[model samples]
Target: MGLGKLLHDHAEHADVGGTIDHPRAYELAAEIGFLGRRREIFTRLAALSGVRPGDRVLDVGCGTGYLTRILAPIVSPAGRVTGVDASAPMVEHARRRAPGNCSYQVGEGQALDLPDAGFDVVVSSLAVHHIPAAERGAALREMFRVLRPGGRLLIAEFRPPTNHLLAQLVGMVSGPAMRHSPHDLLGDLIPAAGFHVQDEGDLPVMLSYVRALRPST
Candidate 1:
């Protein structure tokens, strides 16, 4: 379908949930690049997650596969990288741009249908905030479920809004669900998801990254 149809489809679902589908998804991709945070955020996430040459990685909510592309080379010849998004259009778009070693699938963060204990690392960038407040915990638990014991999970998200005005603005642009995201409560959320917190810190423009691990038991 044409971009028009793609965008129309996105609009149909925009308010139903917090999805950046089609044209807006593409627009956000460009906007992040313009701010120079696109590359920086994913790079830092990769580093913080410590993805190695042979690690099997999953990029949850991997809209259009930008970060999946970045990870393909890092995992290199032996490793595999899979990118999954709830938006089928985004998954299709991502597949077009993905490398040979990278794969794209249609999936949801709150209930991934992937095999359990399969990936060595899972990274989600600025995506989970789109999940409704009530569903965010289930999403984190799914991320935990997909990782192998001792595997790593890294997430990059906007920090909690600094003021009521900013908070309101975030809700308008991102969604109401974002206000209740793990941004401010990572210390607790990560552990509740059955992860051991490894590191947490700020990124550019009110964004933050968290690194956690599934216990090796």
Candidate 2:
């Protein structure tokens, strides 16, 4: 199959944004060389989500459904999990690799077809950087629209300049695509998009996270 078909097919399983070949969080999971770290991260995201029985869940930019599938059991039989991404191949891979309780959708972060207040939790990892810097805020607004009151947004990304020379150097070795993202700025942007920032933490310096909650209007 052609590259496009491969990517599309993968999107059927995971959340892939576009043709851009960017370094994803899975790469870190791979470097860890085990599902344990991935599972740990997924669990943290799920627990932080505050998902309850019968609560609908949306995994925005849910690459490979790692976190999305983990949420399936939390939401339980009554609740549902929808994973939206832009690539067919990623989504396809996610579908094949994930549990049956989760479903996948092909779409952009800036425009989701899901209804207003449709999800109890929306989490994305290493996806905001792939989107154009100008479009990141817009995409965040879209995430807000689909969330139910009291829903939470958790985003994890690599903070830059921790080792600026090292990152650029690694980019040189792994090619430009391996370069780190501007994870530092997201904390400020989250509130600007309307959510209330609840906590901000770091993961071994290179990775940082921001958690925000939507207050009932």
Candidate 3:
């Protein structure tokens, strides 16, 4: 795969925008040492998501289904978990790795093929930033639309370093597509999407976790 694939050129294609193929995606994961922390990160995201038994959950931008696998058993027996990503290769790999309760789809954050108010909890980790910064708000609204009344929304994003040097280093390693600056934007976008911001703080390492909820009607 080319560098553009890993960087995710959002302009070339409108709907399914990401370009990270299986090899490059996994290679990046290994390069960042994210593979080791994958389980821990997924656990934190799932806990913050407040996923309960029998709840329907959606994992947006569920690259390789690492988080989706962690979520399946939590909402098992009667619950269902669906993982979606813009990269077909990622989706394919995730499907191969998925459990009985989990499924994968090729989709984008800004426009999901799911129905309105269908999920009890919607979560994405280190994924939303792949969407173009200009269209992030729309993607947040899309997350909101799929969530049922009183459903939870949890997103795990990079906690940008306060130090300029470290920040630039992080940007360089994570790529230009990571310029969405989740910490700065999600605080506002979640509420604007009609979700009530419930909790926000650091997860482990460089990640920041935000938990929100759709108001019950």
Candidate 4:
């Protein structure tokens, strides 16, 4: 079995790409996948999010709440960070590790059970490709729906290495879901969903990100 299959629970949500049920194992894999720089890379992601103190933030597909933990301090005391994932086990694991200002729930990204325009910022990482390919558009729309007008969004996804051999190796280990170039994976979804894309670029350790905002008007 590929490492992706090993870490995922295919039997649970067969319609969805794959739901990772083993939080501890997923955590270890993420650490190894990032080559011990998960924190550093995620910190940059948080910065790119343009989150401020007292800003209400939402994390979609927040596996194990790793990014939420990094964001907790920044939005602490007054602001809050809410994490949503499809897997109950993953949500439970994140709840255990959640800080006082952070909370978690079991929910789908394509059909979020959140109020419209409720969040100041919304971020999703390595989560879009996990949604069924047909539903990715809905998921991006949902992200736009939940964020207040003028709210910021940051989406980070795995960028396959440029080297052919390394890219094939990544595919073998992680499965086909991660093999897509971020541009192809995202396409015009952000703009189609009503987001004004601000910037996008590659990050170290094979990551790519797009920053966008909901128009205030």
- The regions of model 2 sitting more than 4 angstroms off are 1-36, 164-187
> Sorted on TM-score, highest at the top, how do the candidates line up?
4, 3, 1, 2
**lDDT for each of the candidates?**
0.76, 0.67, 0.78, 0.89
Please give the range of 10 consecutive residues that has the lowest summed lDDT in model 2.
Answer: 8-17
For model 2 the TM-score comes to 0.77
- Report the Cα lDDT for residue 47, model 3: 83
Best by TM-score: 4
Please provide, for model 1 over 53-155, each residue's C-alpha lDDT reduced to its tens digit, 9 standing for 90 to 100.
Answer: 9999999889888788888899998999998888887888888887999998887789898999999999998777556556778888999999999999998
Q: Which regions of candidate 4 are displaced past 4 Å?
A: 9-16
TM-score for all predictions? 0.82, 0.77, 0.85, 0.95
Superposed Cα deviation of residue 46, candidate 1 (Å): 1.5
Reference-based lDDT, residue 26, model 1: 65
> 1 or 3: which has the higher TM-score?
3
The best candidate in terms of lDDT:
4
Write the number of the candidate with greater lDDT, choosing between 1 and 4: 4
- Total clashing pairs for each candidate: 0, 26, 0, 0
